[model samples]
Target chain A: MTPFSYTRAGDAADAVRLGAFGGAKYLGGGTNLVDLLRETIERPSALVDVAGLPATIEEREDGSLLIGAATRNAALAEHRAVRSHYPVLARAILAGASAQIRNMATVGGNILQRTRCAYFYDDEGSRCNKRSPGQGCDALDGFNRIHAILGASADCVATHPSDMCVALAALDATVHLQGPAGTRRLKLTGLHRLPGTRPDLETALEPGELITAVELPALPAGARSTYRKVRDRASYAFALVSVAAVLEADSGTVREVRLALGGVAPKPWRARKAEDALRGGPATVQAFRAAAESELADAAPLRDNGFKVELAKRTITAVLGDLAGVAA
Target chain B: MAIRINGTETRAPADPRVSLLDLLRETLHLTGTKKGCNQGACGACTVLADGERILSCLALAVQFEGRSITTIEGLAGQDGMHPLQLAFIEHDGFQCGYCTPGQICSAVGMAAELARGAPSAVTTDLGAATVRFTGEEARERMSGNLCRCGAHNGIIAAITQTYAGAAL
Candidate 1:
C-alpha cells in the first residue's frame, strides 16, 4: 500500500479545506477506501478523517427524515422513525453488507463506495476505462457476467454496487453537499452518472465536496414498499439483480408507484418507463410483467450476461406482484 | 497516536496505512485478533470499539486515536476463562481455531446489541425494539465469520448454550 498522511477534520469547513488541497479524500468508515488503498487502486496524498461530523437523524415537521451523512448504516437501519416510515430503506441497508461492515460504514461513505468489479481492481492487467481513462474496457469482451446491461457506453460497463442508493432513488431522497464553492442539493437519481465516455467521473459530487446529509421526502399514506435482491448466495454477496419499489394500489388499480433497479446499469436505474405503464393500470401479474419488460426493453446485454435481462424482468415482476398481492 | 486497548493505553507512531488489525498484531503484539481475508471479506479481524463490533482490518490506526478497543485477548478475566470461552471449549466450537477470536468477539458484541434491543436483518419487523435470538438469527448475524473447518454447528451450540445460561 502507498503511504499517505492522515489528518482529522475538525468540522465540515475543515474537511473541505483539506479536501481542496488536491489529492485528498474524506475518510469515513474506511471500509472501501482503505481496501482500494491496499490494492493500490486509489493512491491519495492525504486522507482527511471525516467521521466526527454531525451524525444524527432529525425528523422534520412533516414526518420526513433528515439523516446526517456520517450516520452509521446500523443506526439508520434501526432508527425508530426510519423503520416505521421508511422500512424499505432499513431493509435495503440490512440486506446489504454484513453486521460488522454496516456498523462501520457511514451513509455518505456507502454512497461513495466503489464498485466491486474485478476488472477495475486489476490495476496491472485489466484494461478498465474507469480506472484508467481512454483505455479499452476489458469487461466488454472479458468476463462480464456481472457487467452493466443499461446506461453503458463503449468506454465502460461497470455497474454500481450499492443497495442503499437503489432505495434512496425510489424514495426521492435529496443529497445535501457542501463544497468549496458552497452548498447544493442534488437529487439522488442525478447523483451517479452513466458510464458515458467518462466512467471515471462517476458521481456528481464536485471535487472537494462533502456530503452533509440526505433528506427523505415523506412517502404517500398507505404506500407499501420492499427491496428484493437476488444474488449468488443468500448472504455476503453482491446483487445479481436488485429491485426497490414503492407502490400504492386502490380498488385493485395502481395509484402511485416508484421503481428502481440495481446491478443492471451504471447507476441506480429508476424504472420511470415501468412506473408510467403501471400508474392507473390494474395490479395484475400480467401487467407487472409487461411493465417490467417495457422498462428493460432497451437493455443491451453482453455475451455472458444476456440472462440478466430475464432475471431483472422476473425479479421486478415478483416484487411488484408481492406488493400488489398478485401471485407470480 | 495513543489508544486504549484491553484496558491498557498503547501508542503506535504515526502510520496512516497500517490497519488496526496490523497495529494490534504487529506493533502491539496482540495476535489473538486473526487476519483471515484482510480485505474485510472475512470477519476474523473483528473487534469491539466502544462496545460495538467493527472490522478492524479496514480501520486505520490513526482514526482510532482515543477510542477504546476490546480484543479477544481481553475477554478472559483474572478468574480464568470467560464463560463464553469455557462454553466454546465444552461444546467443541472450533477445529482449526482460526476464526474463534472473531467469532467470540462478534458474539460478545451481538449479545450487547440484543441487550440494547437492536434488531437484526432476519427480524421481520424492523420497528420492534428487540428481536429474540433464534439459531437462525445467530447464524445470520455470524455469517461474516467464515469457518472453513465446518464448525458452525458447534459454534452455534456454544453460543446458544452460553446465552441461555446467562439468561438463567
Candidate 2:
C-alpha cells in the first residue's frame, strides 16, 4: 500500500473538500478499497473516510425510501420497510458476499467497487487496460469464464460484480451525489458506464464526487418482486447469472414490470427491451422466454462464457414466470 | 481517542496501512483471532465491532477510533467459557481448530442478527420479523467461516445446540 494520510470527514462537505484534491479518494467501509490498496491497485495520496456520515434509512410518507449512502449493507437488508416493500433489494443484498462482508460494506462502496476480474487484480503480471490504459486486456484471451456477455467493448469485457445494484436498477433508484460543483442526481442505471474505452473510469461521478443517498421510488401496490442469483456454490460466491424483477400482472396479462440482470454485463443491465415486450402481453412462461430471448439477442459472449447467454435467459424467464404466478 | 478492543483502550497504529487484524495479532498480541486468508474471502479475521460482526483484515485500525471491538479473547467471561464455546468443545467442532475463533465470533454475531430479525439468504419469508433458527440457516450464516478440516457438521451442530433453543 502506498503511504497515505487518512482523515475522518466531519460531514459531506468536509468529505468533498478533502476528496476533491488530486490523488484523493473517498473511503467508505474500506471493504473493497482496503483490498485494492493492499494489492497496490489503487494508490491514492490521501483518503477521506466517510463511514461516519448519517447512516439513516428514512421512510417517506409518499411510500418511497431514502437511504443514506453510509448505511451498511446489513442495515439496508435488515430494515423492516425494505424487507416488506422492496423484498428484491433485501434478497439481493443477502445473496451477495457474506454476513461479515455485508456488515462492513457500505452502499456507496458497493456501487463503486471494481470489477472482480482476475486480470484486473493480477497487477504483478497481467496486463489490463483498466489497470493501465492502452495496455491490452488479458481476459480477452485468458480464462474468462466470468467475463462480460453484454454491453462490452473490444477494450474491456469485465462485468460488474454487484447484486444490490441489479435490484436497485430494477427499483428505479436515484443516486444523490455531492461534488465540487454541488449536488446532482443520476439514475442508478445510468450511474455505471458500460466499459467503453476507459474501464478505469467506471461511474459517471465527477472527480471527488461523493454519493450521499439513494432514493427508491414507490412501487405499484401488490407488485411482486424477487432476486435470484445462480452461482457455483450455495453461498459466499459471486453470481454467475442473476435476475431482479418486480412484476405486476392482472387477469393473466402483464400490467407493469421492471427487470434487471447482473453478472452478465459491464453494468447492472436494466432489461428494458424485455420489459417493453412483456407489458400488455400474456403472462405466460412462453411469453417470458420470448421476451428474455429478445433482450439477450445482442449478447456477445467470449470463448468460456457462452453458456451465460442461455443461463441468463432461463433465469430471467423463470423469475418472471414465478412472479406472474405461472409454472415455469 | 483510541479503539477499545476487548475492553482495553488500545492506541491506533501510526501507519494507516495497518489493518485491525494486524493491530490485534501483531501489536496487541491477541492471537486468538486467526488470520486465514487476509483478503476478507475467509472469515478467519471476523470480530465484533459494536456487537456487529465485521472482517478485521479489511478494517483499518485508524478507522475504528473510539469503537468497541470484541475478539475471541474477550468472548469468555470470568465464569470460564461462553456457552457456545462449551458447546463447541462438547460437539467436537474442530480438527485443527484454526477457524474456531472466527466461527465462534461469527456465530455469536449471527445469533444477535437472528434475534433482531436479520434474515439470511436461505430465509424463506422476507417480511417475517424473526426467522426460525434451523440447521440450514446456521449453515448459510456461517458459510463465511470456512473450515478445511470438514468440521462443518460439528460446527453447525454446536451452533444449533447453542442457539436453536433461544427465543429467536
Candidate 3:
C-alpha cells in the first residue's frame, strides 16, 4: 500500500475541512478503501479516520430510526429497534459479505462501497470507464455475466453491489450529510447515480461531503417485508439478483408494495413500474410474474447476462409470492 | 498508537497503512493470525476486535488505537488448550492447518456472540436476541472463512462439540 499521512477527524467539521484540503479520503471501516489502496486503484495523499465518531443508533419519538453513518453493519443488524421495525434492512445486511466483514464495515462505507466489476479491479489492463473515465468498457463483451442488466449505458455496465442500500431504497430512507458547504438530506435513490455519461461520478456527494447519518422514515404499519438474495452459493458470494420486497396486503389485495432490485442496475433500482402493477391487484403468482415482466421489459441484457432477466423475473415472483402466500 | 492484544498492551510500528493482521504477525511477532486473501473475502485473517470478530487484514492498525484485540494465540491457558482448540484436535478439524488460527479465532468470537444472544439471518424473529446454534447456523456464520483442504466436516464437528460442551 502507498504511504499516506493518517489524521483522526475530531469532528464532522474537521473531517470536511481535512477532506477539502485535497487528495484526502475519509476512512470509515476501511474494508473497500483499504482494499482499493492495496490494489492501487485509489491513491489518496492522506486518510482521515472517522471511526471514533458517535456512531450509535437511536429511535426518535416519531418511531423513526436515525442510524449513524459510522455504525457498523453488525450493530445495525442486531439493533433491537431495527430488527423489530425494519427487519428487511437487518436481513439484507446480514445476507451480505460475512460476520467478520459485517463487524468491520460501517453503514456509510457499505453504501459507498464500490462495484464488484472485475474489469474495474483489473489494474493491469482492463478498459473500465468507472475506474478511468473516457476509457472503454471491457465488461460490455468480456465475461459480462455479472454486468448490469438495468440503468446501464454503453460506457459502463457495472451493477451496484450493496444489499443494505436495496433495503434502504424500499424503506424510503434519507441520507443525512454534513459538508463544508452545509448540511443536507437526500433520498436514497438520489444518492447513487446510474452509469450514464459520467460513470466515474458514482455518488451525488460533493468532494468534501461526509455522510453523518441515515434516517429511515416509519415503515408501513404491519408491512411484511423481506430481502431475498440469489447467489451462486448460499453465502459469502455477491448477489446474482437480490430483491427487497416491502408489501402490505388487505383481504388478498395488494394494498401497497415497494420493490427494489440489487445486482441488476447501476443503482439500487426502485421498481416503481412493478410496484404500480402489483398495487391494488390480486396477490397471485401470475400477477407477480406480470409485474416483474412489466418492469424488466426495459432490461437490455448483454449476451452473457441474458439469463439474468429470467432469474430476476423468478426472484421477483418468488419473493412477492412468499409474502402473498402463493405457491411459487 | 497502542492497542491491547491478547491481554498485552503494545504499540504499533511506524507505518500508518499496516493492517492489523501484519501488525500482529509481522510487527508483534505473533504469527497466529494468517493472511489469505488480504481482502475481506477470506476469513483466514480473522481476529477479535473488542470481543467481536473482524477481518484483521482489512483493518488498519491505526484504527484500532485503544481497542482490545484477541488473536488465536490468546485462546489457551497454561494448563493445556482452549476447549475449541482441543475439540479441533480431537475432530481433526484441519489438514495443512494454514486456516486453523483464523477459524479458531472466528469460532471464539462466534461463541461470544451466541452468548450475547445475537441473531443470524436465519432467525425467524429479528428482534429476538436469543438464538439457537445449529449446524446450519454455524455453516452460514462461518462462510467467510474458506478451507481449501475441505476439512469442513471436521471443523463443523469441532464447533458443534464445543457448543454442546458450553451449553452443558
Candidate 4:
C-alpha cells in the first residue's frame, strides 16, 4: 500500500475540509478501500476516516426512516424498525457478504463500493476503463460472464456488485450529502450513473461530497416487499441477477409496485417499465413474466452474459409471483 | 492512541498502511491471527472487535485506535482453553489447522450475534425477536471464513456443541 496519512474526522465539516484536499478519500470501515489500497488501484495521499460519524438509525414520527451513513451494515440489518417495516433492506444486507464483513462495513461505504469485475481488479494485466480512463476494457471480450447487459457503454461492461443498493432503489430512498458547498440530497436511483463513455465517473457525488444519511419514505400500509438474489452458490457470493420488489395488491389486482434489478446494469437498474406495466394489472404468473420481459426488452447482452437476460427475467417473475401468491 | 488487545494496551503501528492482521502477527508478535487472503475474501484473520467478529486483514490498524480487539489468544483465560477450543479438539474440527483460530473466534462471535437475535441469510423470520442457532444458521454466518481442508462438518459439530442452549 502507498504511504498515506490517516486522520479521524471530528465532524462532517472537518471530514469535508480534510477530504477536499486533492488525492484524499473518505475512509469508511476500510473494507473495499483497504483492499484497493493494497492493490495500488487507489493511491490517495491522505485518508479522512469518517467511520465514527453519526451512526444512528432514527425513526421519524411520520413513519420514515433516517439511517446514518456511518451506521454499520449489521446494525442496520438488526434494527427492529428496519426488520419490521423494511424487511427487504434487512434481508438484502444479510444476503450479501459474510457476517464478519457486514459487521465491519458501513452503509456509506457499501453505497460507494466499486464494481467486482475481474478485469477492473486486474490492475497488472487487464486494461480497465474504470481503473484508467481512455484505456480499453477487457471484460468486453474476455470471460465476460458477469458483465453488464444493460446501461453499459462500449468502453466498459462492468456491473455494480451491491445488493443493498438494489433494495434502496426499490424503496425510493434519498441520500443526504454534505460537502464543501453545503448540503444537498439525491434520490438513490439517481446517485449512480450508467457506464457511459467515462466509466471512471461512477456516481453523481462531487469530489469531497460526504454521504451523511439515507432516508426512506414511508411505504404504503399494505405493501409487501422482498429481495431475491441468484448466485452460483448460497451465501458470500455476489449476485448474478437479483430482484428487489415492493408489491401492493388489492383482491388480486396490483395497486402499486416498485422494482429494481442488480448485477445486470452499470448501476442499480430500476425496472420502471415493469412497475408501470404491473400496476393496476391482474397479479398472475403470466402477468409477472410479461412485465419482466418488458423490462429486459432493451437489454443488449455480451457474448458470455446472454444467459443473464433470461435468468434475470425468470428471477424477476419468480420473485413477483411468489409475492403475489401465484404458482408457476 | 493505543489499541487494547487481549486486555493489554498495545501501541498501534505508526505506519498507516499496516493492516490490523499484520499489526497483530508482525508488530506485536501475536501470531494467533492468521492471514489467508489479504483481501476480504477469506476470513482467516477473523477477530472480535468490541465482541463483534470482523476480518482483521481488511481493517487498518490506524482506524481502530482505542478500540478493543480480541484474537484467538484472548478467548481462553488463566483457567485453561476455551470450551469451543476443547470442543474443536474433541470433534477433530481441523486437518491442517490453518483456519482453526478464525473458526473458533468466529464461532464465539456468532454465538453472541445469535443470542442478540442478529439474523443470518438463512434466518426465516426476520421479525422474530430471537434466533435459533441451527446448523444451517452456522453455515450461513460462517461463510466468510473458508476452510480448504474440508473440515466444515466437524467444525460445525464443535460449534454446535460448544454453543448449545445459547439461543433464546
Model 3 regions lying over 4 Å from their true place: none
Per-candidate TM equals 0.98, 0.99, 0.98, 0.99
Better of 1 and 3 by DockQ: 3
Which segments of candidate 2 are over 4 A away from where they belong?
none
Q: Candidate 3: TM of chain A?
A: 0.98
Candidate 3, residues A1-328, lDDT tens digits: the string is 7779988998888888888868898899998999999999999999988776769898998889999899999899988888888888999999999999999889989989999999999978899888989988999989999888999999999999999999999999999999889999999999999878899999999988998899998877868889999999999888989999998987889999999999999999999999999999999899999999999999999979998999999999999999888798
lDDT of 1 by residue, A1-328 (tens): 7878999998899999999988898999999999999999999999999988989999999978999999999899888888889878988898888889999999999999998889999999888899999888899999899989989999998999999999999999999999999999999999998878999999988999999999999999989998999989878788889999999998899999999999999998999999999999999999999999999999999989999999999999999999999899
Model 4, span A250-326: residue lDDT tens: 89999999999999999999999999999999999999999999999999999999999999999999998888888
The candidates, ranked best first by lDDT, are 2, 4, 1, 3
* Per-residue lDDT of model 3, residues B42-61, tens digit only: 79999998889999998889
RMSD of 2: 0.7
The residue pairs found clashing in candidate 4 are none
Score candidate 3 by lDDT: 0.90
- Report lDDT per candidate: 0.91, 0.95, 0.90, 0.93
Worst 10 residues of 2 chain A by lDDT: A194-203
Model 2 lDDT per residue over A1-328, tens place = 9999999999999999999999999999999999999999999999999999979999999999999999999999999999999999999999999899999899999999989999999998998999999999999999989999999999899999999999999999999999999999999999999888888888899998999999999999979999999999999999999999999999999999999999999999999999999999999999999999999999999999999999999999999988988999
Measured against the native two-chain assembly using Cα atoms, what DockQ does each of the candidate structures obtain, in the order listed? 0.84, 0.91, 0.86, 0.94
- Report each candidate's C-alpha RMSD, comma-separated, in the order given: 1.4, 0.7, 1.2, 0.8
DockQ of 2: 0.91
Q: What docking grade does candidate 1 earn?
A: high
